[model samples]
Target: MQTISKNITTLLLLSVVFSFGGCKKFLSVTPSTQSVNPVTIKDFQEILNSDSLSRTQFFPLDLMTDDVALTDNQFNTGDNFYRRIYTWDALIWNPAQIDFMYNYSYAKILQMNVILSRIDAAKKDALNTPQTKNLIVSQALTNRAWYYLQLVNTYGAAYDVSTSKTDPGVPLVLTPDAYALPARASVEQVYGSIISDLKKAAANTDMPSKGIDIIHPGKAAVYGLLARTYLYKGDYESASLFADSALTQESRLLDLTQNPYMPNQLQDLNTNPEVLLGRISSDEGFFKTYSNTFVIGGSLLDSLGGFSTADKRFSNRFSTSRFSPGVYKQNQLNAQTMVFDNSVAVPEIMLIKAECLARKGDFSAAGDLLDKLRSSRIINYSPSGRTYTADNILSYVIGERRRELCFHGGLRLFDLKRFNKGTPFRQSILRTSYSGTNYAELLPGSVLYLLPLSAYVLAANPNILQNPR
Candidate 1:
């Protein structure tokens, strides 16, 4: 088992160097009515690495539902329904969310397949030369796995213990072959496939430190992703352990005191030690709502005790400018964002560790691990300051996670779904329609987790299984 894992990791690294794409092409692609393979690494990378591509293709429902604020659209069909559909706090996501996803990911999958096929067939000299050959292959495989993870998470149902084998999930697209539009597998199969990809990544890749350039995923990033996958699997022990592995490589938070809060600074283009992976994955277009000037959402505000002044979170993490009676300030989008996209740093690992520990009922270790994070970012570190109980400690941990991690592109919706809180779309909406909803309104057991397989995918591969609502 161990030997196989190592060989796969080596392959993943070769894949990364092989996985080159430009920002523009990565986001958008028009698939052939019939299955076709892209010609080269550059072509394949263009589609896979694109921010527009990733935003549109990578993970569609993440923001629209509630891991973060939904981008406002005049189109009115998307996140707009957060309030209405979730009127019961019952989350009925846009079926159309699956449209971009199916197209983009399969396009990526195809590109990867072409690369993989070429890798297998290329002359030994071409494949072995440049030292980077292995790196590129490793990258390609990891990215392919990434696409699968996103597709499954959005479209598939939660992985249930007893019924996962019987439950519906997204199609497991391994080969980019045109003939292979597969059917929906069980949720177990989807996760199993993701694990396989990460295992490949972990074994084959060599992490390049954030020395000259830091935006790309290398060894640590893939390992971190593996840790994340384990967490989602509810394998608390493995999750915490894998997260530790990632952290051991790169573990430091951005120094709030010394660093400037200017837009460029947030990127830490240096691939600051704080960041474990690529600098950032650009979301499509500027995020609709988040700005450097953050306004408190009424739900968040009320939860904060009263004024933005009331919660240390509002005061410490964000700089607020008031407009209406309820709304406060949050991140405002502008030009500098393009130069530096979203980057994942070490605190994510800390939270992963803390949460996984808490899940295991190891409250003392979890609380200790979690509080240390709060202690650093915040002033006045009295353990009992926030009225500490195990649950209180956990809530504070999550609250800190929410406040500290917002707009930076961390796991907000994952937490929601993991905890089964996917329905209540209410929090901080400038638009009233989406606000005012509460927890009880969100229908937890409803078919909320399912995502429709897009028309494009169905058209291309009539065989692809649809996740039924």
Candidate 2:
């Protein structure tokens, strides 16, 4: 079936498994019509292998960021929910319409929950032993934790250590009961659970360093998720440690200078050795669709342009050919086929390490790390001779982060949100519409950055309150 359920309750009631499909309605669950009850280890593996789960992360959420801009025509005629998100509207969806972002995320969570709930009792044989069950549990936990991170970052406030305990996060549904109407957990609680799940996954030494495919979460992927989680929580030291641990397992970077292929290594997950885990769009011709609707924002294009022509990413990852004369759009989000790679790649982990070092006031080390990454993507890249100070190092890394991770997985938005939590890292974004006359500015403290809970969800479950407008 194409859809799981109509709302969160239905999502809890059913498990969705399928070839990739549209995100039109992925929110609900109905056992009678769409559920696949897992009774065997092989069955659980099949559920985990479904492409639908990979497509459930923040791929579409990029539409809301400063890096993308809608044409005036598309702004008025495109997906209504996306149009609202583009302008930071207080409400992006009506009570009747499905919030695919919310639905798809919880849909994956539901399947993970289903597996976790059933895997223990699943039949074991020669190939499926107790160790196999442990590995399966670990993968499910890791996948669940990853999806929760996406949910909390999108639906909750930017994580502040001082306030996360009180900030409302998305619901923490850990069971397979379709009738469960879990209340929103505190951001702290959600993060706590995420860390706990990832830690458990990492503890399972029996798991492979890498999986059979990128879609599966291996030890490296588990560690990568941990690093990303700790980074979001502003625990830079922990982030750096886990990032290092992850790189120890998988550190290959796709050298843009050496790859002469038309699409390059970054476009295909299978070809990229750097990818620790793979999550992707629905192979739904997303870029082709985006080309018709949006252009890369001028400011981002300018930032990409400022990097020297030696920088292969700027040339290979983007193009003006998709749009009119001067308008540019990202080209490497996916290959000619579809499927955009949203995996936690080595570059992102490297960037994480670099940012952590900069935060520790080790500018020289941070710059060296940053330069190492730049050298891989840019030919004949010389290390910066400019002396670095605490004043500029983090900002420099942040800029590099925007360039390196932009449009990858709604990451720029996440970076912006986290930076706004406090201090010199705080940023403000002014979003100008396709028509320059209208503008919406998101300050460091603006509630506009936080997406509200889906109205349909609120109407269906009274326990779940909406985020502050």
Candidate 3:
């Protein structure tokens, strides 16, 4: 997230989505486009099992935050270009990100819907202790919720807590169709459907709560997402409760018990125990980048007042050099840098707890929680300096999130919009340096930022509505 921080060396854009692919498995879509036997559950699940599909699912796949990368040196809306996303001024979408967002996302949504439709058929038993069919249904609902949530974020606006209940959101399509165009739904309706799906996910106690649900849906994962939806809606009490629910069973945070900043430890950036949910993306074509073209790691020391000794991220994670920030990456990389990999850590539930509490007006309590995380991540601990008046506590919380949650996923951009902090970066963002989209400004509540309606989408639903300019 930092232009380049001290120790963090990985390019966040590589895995900026919910996931970055390992190129571990090639995708093989079922039904072969014409085999037409009403796509079975296992067949659909097999498609979901592909490494590409797992890495490129909704919400996680399309991250355009302050931390991610662009395909071109500059932000231009063209084939395979990330920078162009900054300029929606072009007559048409750059197509790569857009096609993935609208066409691919909806296609995935249809896949989930197909699985959901046949969940009952998959169930051979009426009363089962633990059945595969039940798992499929529960997971399908959860996946559907997540996919729609991602769709909403791309095509729709950031969830507005004040008017979301009355706001129109994206269409909640469950069943697949070759024909049948749909219109954009209200934000309220979109969130409503997503919540309903999550409830189904939470209710299914039979499901396990383990690692990332990139392949399918997990109860804990759904709860984790629900927590975000609630946070976006400004419903802190629920957000806190759900975040607690997600983290209650396990702790996936990087286990940084061993001193992280020790130089020897810095050599093995990939295995740093602090990573909770990380993906090393070898297929994103980062290794090909020139060695010096890597994400700057030591920028924090230069920018954030010489990197406070108390800041754990600087002391432990960054390595300063004359050129690059050298935070986590021991060496630098350039385009065609496939020998290396990109990663994403699905941040711990503990941070979300702090965020939800801070949003809820419990500044004293929130500060205590935030400090707990800060202490763990810093070279030195000073609780005395952590005190905050209620007035400035939220700002402090937002700042802490920026530091702790940088370059993890698509979060920085969303965080900027939610707290209304994009103005600071409008001109200062170093558009040519990183996140190359030369967005003169982060569009505040504009229709342009909304995903362009796909041609298929427009043709299907005659009554479908386009986003307002």
Candidate 4:
């Protein structure tokens, strides 16, 4: 158990002061002063809406996976931090290498905890109406759940029903007491907390129907997050139901064909029709380095299928890298600096529904859903010659997920962890060396899937255990 005072100190030092130029509506109410503690619902809402705290990056996870390939020159010039992650080396033991994500995630969680603890005091002070209080509580709960999910998935083992009870998860801190000390909880406990929070959020009907700003979590975003959580848990039925609910609430997919390219303007979080919940990564500049170092994997490019050139996703989302002539870099976001999209979008919900249906043996239903998504992403996509049977439906759905969400937010790694559970679906991840002569492989049940905790965390808390190297 680490003292919460230490945690608070670390959080304050690492917190980024986010500017809200694009999200004026959501944060229209200005705070009195930073010196004053947040006691009003509006103040808390602004905290939740801060993209600086909420937006996160899992760039190391992307490097660990197979979707990215580094050029020889780029690899040699890259820092030891990234190289260590790419090779899954013991060098990652240094807190400096991975502390940004650890600190950033916990900082947001700490804010949520503070808001939750103070909401009652705010209510007593008549700082909020019933509706505003309920909304505040709901938003804080969901936001906390989201941060915990990110922490658990990165630090703990993949959620397996049989093993989750014993799997070491990140510490669960639910209060704002800076002096309180808490120990790590099991993976099962972490997920239980997440589900409980989401359920409470779902019951808060007073919450705004949609986010005044995309960065803030709304009703549809809650459903989408629930769907993602269940999908990771392998609860396909619940995942499907939640995905459908989310789609019904807000189903908007941008027609990429109509406007194939937006070089200077990559992510339109303010007006993007497809984004249900918009959150960018703190490492917005890392995208430029990532593009300089890595290119799309050959196998990943091949999986795009016959309409690769014709598909708007292919034509609009990628371009030849100036850094490496033979390499193609992801261009979905900023052309110069990549801004990773951590939002819940229409395509993800559709894929979740498709996957759940396939898992339930509803091949036709799943195919129909896949086609609907495909039609939107690909120009003139039709089902006339395509066939998706039960035997291959799951494969198709998985392929679509991979193609649709390659470098979105380490989603490929997450999916790999979930799908690697069963013997039939289990697969290995292999990455070749710079020369392509040697390969590093991560087996289905490899401990490497669970990232090692930052050395600072272990040093501060003797009770905390590090993931096996």
Please give each candidate's TM-score.
Answer: 0.71, 0.86, 0.70, 0.88
Error of model 3, residue 44, in angstroms:
5.6
Better of 1 and 4 by TM-score: 4
Candidate achieving higher TM-score, 2 or 3: 2
Each prediction's whole-model lDDT (CA): 0.53, 0.73, 0.51, 0.72
Q: Which stretches of candidate 4 lie over 4 Å from their true place?
A: 1-36, 93-98, 123-127, 261-267, 282-293, 306-308, 321-336, 433-435
Name the best candidate (by lDDT). Answer: 2
163 Cα displacement, candidate 2 (Å): 1.1
Per-residue lDDT of model 2, residues 39-135, tens digit only: 7877776666654556544545676677877677666566665567777888777778767778877777777887888777777666578788888
Which clashing pairs does model 4 show? 5-178
RMSD in angstroms between candidate 4 and the native structure over all alpha carbons? 4.0
Highest-TM-score candidate:
4
lDDT of 4 by residue, 354-391 (tens): 99999888999999988887887777777887898989
Error of 1 at 279 (Å): 6.8
Query: After TM-score superposition, what is the CA distance of residue 270 in candidate 2 from its true location, in Å?
Result: 0.8
User: What global local distance difference test value does model 1 have?
Assistant: 0.53
Q: Higher-lDDT candidate among 1 and 3? A: 1
lDDT of 1 by residue, 1-469 (tens): 9768755664553344233332342213332212133344444334334433233223234333333232233223344433333222233434444454465566566556666667544444432543445555666676677667666666666555677787767777665333344777777888887788767766763535331234346666676777777877778788888888878777776654344332333233453566654434333333343332213444455544555343354454334445333322223464323222335457777887887776656778778876677655544555775555565556656666665555443255455556663323223322333544333323344454455555556666676665544
- Residue 133 Cα positional deviation in candidate 1, in Å, after optimal superposition: 3.2
Lowest lDDT 10-residue stretch of candidate 1:
26-35
| C-alpha lDDT of residue 105 in model 2 | 76
Per-residue CA lDDT of model 3 for 46-127, tens digit only, reads 5445444333322222234444333344233333333344334343443232355565556556656666765555533333
